[model samples]
Target: TEGLVMAKNSSAADQLELIALAVRGNVSLALAARAVRSAVEAGEYEAIARALADQAGRNDPLQPRDRALAATVAAELSRLGSKAAPLWQVAREAWELERSAWWLAYALFREAEALLSAAGKRDAARDVLVRARSIARLLEAAPLLAEIDALAGRGRVDLGSPSPQLLDPVPDRKLPISDREMEVLVLIAKGLTNKEIASELFISERTAAHHVGHIFDKLGVSNRVEAASVAHQAGVLVEDT
Candidate 1:
């Protein structure tokens, strides 16, 4: 229940914690999946995508378990119409490099789902699944083969186009500030000192100062005053009425 609540809150960090708990036998896989789905729905797509990318980058050859998990998450994001193309590419490359047939088949199945659900490329999706089925058959992966068959049997159903709000363009003058760092910048704009900002954000003053330094570096500013000015000029800060 706590896991579900955390999922409902859409905190990517909390969802990742829930996943760790699942790996430790403290939570169910279903609950973890729900939490991840909720986080994606809540616009935590970049966090999840970044996490998957980090995981893919950690292992040189990409362990089978890691590859499977990354592929599964990428596929689920695709099903939810998230921009998971990069994640899919990472999984595909890892599998190809390792020559792991079973995981490759699994990744292919998910890649097909991404193609169909996210990109709306039906013919391409079918071709991907066809290749997955071939690999599954060759490796005697019965479960994967069954899944491919079921997907093929269902035919195409509209999953609805992605929402325009989800397609909002990144700012041309986007700084490298992280989401938390942006929050720090907002507080700075409000004229909050580092100690006050730390209190407001429930972090230590040292941490707040660290974020301020990062904000300065990312925004190409030297001090809080300059950072605040740049934030306002860049339309990154909202003014009070």
Candidate 2:
């Protein structure tokens, strides 16, 4: 449906209204999924997360792609501290429903990401990344391959090679902060609060907080002072532009 496009620049209330209407009217599952995505992209977390979990968990049939997408979104929201659904259960269900599909690979990538972030789950994440890598190569999907490889490097997962050349992830960077995280780190070094960081970077405050959490984890710090000290020592704390 054209509802997603129409909701693109819409207010939060309008987007939520359209989604509620779609759900109540029994619109196409795919259309409702698109509406959910649009709302998520606009940073509507609480209501969107609740609605997504309800639809995805309902007994209705879901297409393979939509199933994986729902899982992916749920996992990301879970990472941001939403109480919608458990990440492991959601991710596993998405792949179990459609093994050996491109969408499964994407969901697995997200699963690996969520696992990698959790304590004591690096081994599981590595295993999931290996599976995702195999599918990416099978599909000859250069982009997905690159994404998985980069993630593997960051997570320090040594995905064993078939022919060795098939898994050429870039070497783990000495400093593992991503480009966007680098931007956030710089802002953090300047003592910006999460809301201030969001305003400066044009991202949702929730996303800004997520980035800060990742930054702290990657830098092995609990607070901004420690994070900034580590960055300065690592020479990643150049003057903020």
Candidate 3:
């Protein structure tokens, strides 16, 4: 898969190509954006951001989906480059132009780390994040929903409606870690952040962070990168847990 390939270290040119695809409104804009962010130099991001803004400007009145993608591309590009604050504002207007669920949620779902890491931009992140999460709910994209919830970190976000059937059954077992905690650990070992783990488990970010702290205490590892290596070495995240 292109996503799996992007997950591994790839050349800057390959990542830039992905960015180009995303800028041109390709379906995997989130994955491509992430690949570019991870692989390309910071200086290159501005050029890509400009390309996204330009692509977003070419709205096709006949294709609502393409119009939606234009907005999504504008929104997705906000996560990159030093000019994010202004791009984020542009993205917000684009978001307001459409109300229904679309690929924008997919793009915003990938914005978790970047948005949350932006410090002073929490206000900006929140305004757009609310729309993104709502759209995710309408789309019934559970993983995307969870990612939004966990990253929101407020723990009180109204998830719109419950869809218990869509979620994996909460496993039950006896071990140093609860089944839920174990599940979090497995996701962690799989390179999911606490936010992504929370999304995957349909839990709160605060809860996810707490579970991770406990997992670290139990496993005697200090950080998630270390936790992944240690868990693999000890077979702690084995299947059929």
Candidate 4:
């Protein structure tokens, strides 16, 4: 217990030290923003937000980019609380700050999905799915396109009528990537991080990063949560990690 406490304290100190270094301009604000975004993408949203808040609390005049990042993080926190209107608005504002096309496509897809579902509009959902399919195809993201196709195929479409299928159990063999990519997808669906994937695959972290990049491109997702959702829809999620 004593050793564990010391370790925890050391970890906290390290984080604080890193934050201080960042504030002192020892690192680019973009690097700090990337770290925060990575934390959020890894589903560590609270940590990301808290870190941002801590930096902001230091009463420093953050670079314009960092200020924008802070605003985005605040918006994400609001979104987590189920405020639909504000959430969507903030999501768009934040989307403009990043240059990653994959990220923007993923965000737009999310917005379309939200709009479709929120208005009880199944027909619109189908349309959005079709558009998402087109975008994924244009990006040469075949695996993601297949996943979208599967979604479109799973439900009946008749004048916005709704008969939702059981999403947790579907055909697992319909994965759209190569076998190796599928293996990574299954692990991702099981909620494994890239580090964990590297350890499991006995590969270097760089190799694992490469696989994850390919998976995201092929899967048409910019983050793991979306990939996991699609995997669940396709019945790729297994009982264990």
| Per-candidate local distance difference test | 0.65, 0.68, 0.59, 0.55
Misplaced by over 4 Å in model 4 are 1-81, 84-89, 96-99, 120-131, 151-241
Better of 1 and 4 by lDDT: 1
Error at 50, model 4, angstroms: 11
Residue range with the least summed lDDT across 10 consecutive positions in model 1 = 159-168
Can you write out model 3's per-residue Cα lDDT over 20-55, one digit (the tens) per residue?
Answer: 554444444454466456545565666666655655
RMSD of each: 20.0, 12.6, 13.4, 18.3
- Tens-place lDDT digits, model 1, residues 124-205: 7777777888899898888788777655543332223221121123477576777667778878988999998765554668
Q: After superposition, which runs of candidate 2 have C-alpha atoms over 4 Å from their true positions?
A: 1-25, 28-47, 61-66, 79-85, 88-92, 162-241
Best by lDDT: 2
Better candidate number, 1 or 3, judged by lDDT:
1
lDDT of 4 by residue, 99-169 (tens): 44444444444444444435365656566555555567688876665545544433333223332222333
Q: Candidate 3, clashing residue pairs?
A: 146-199
Q: Which 10 consecutive residues of model 4 have the lowest summed lDDT?
A: 157-166
Off by over 4 Å in 3: 1-43, 51-89, 98-113, 120-127, 139-184, 191-217, 220-241
What lDDT is reached at residue 197 by model 3? 70
Q: Where does candidate 2 have its weakest 10-residue lDDT segment? A: 161-170
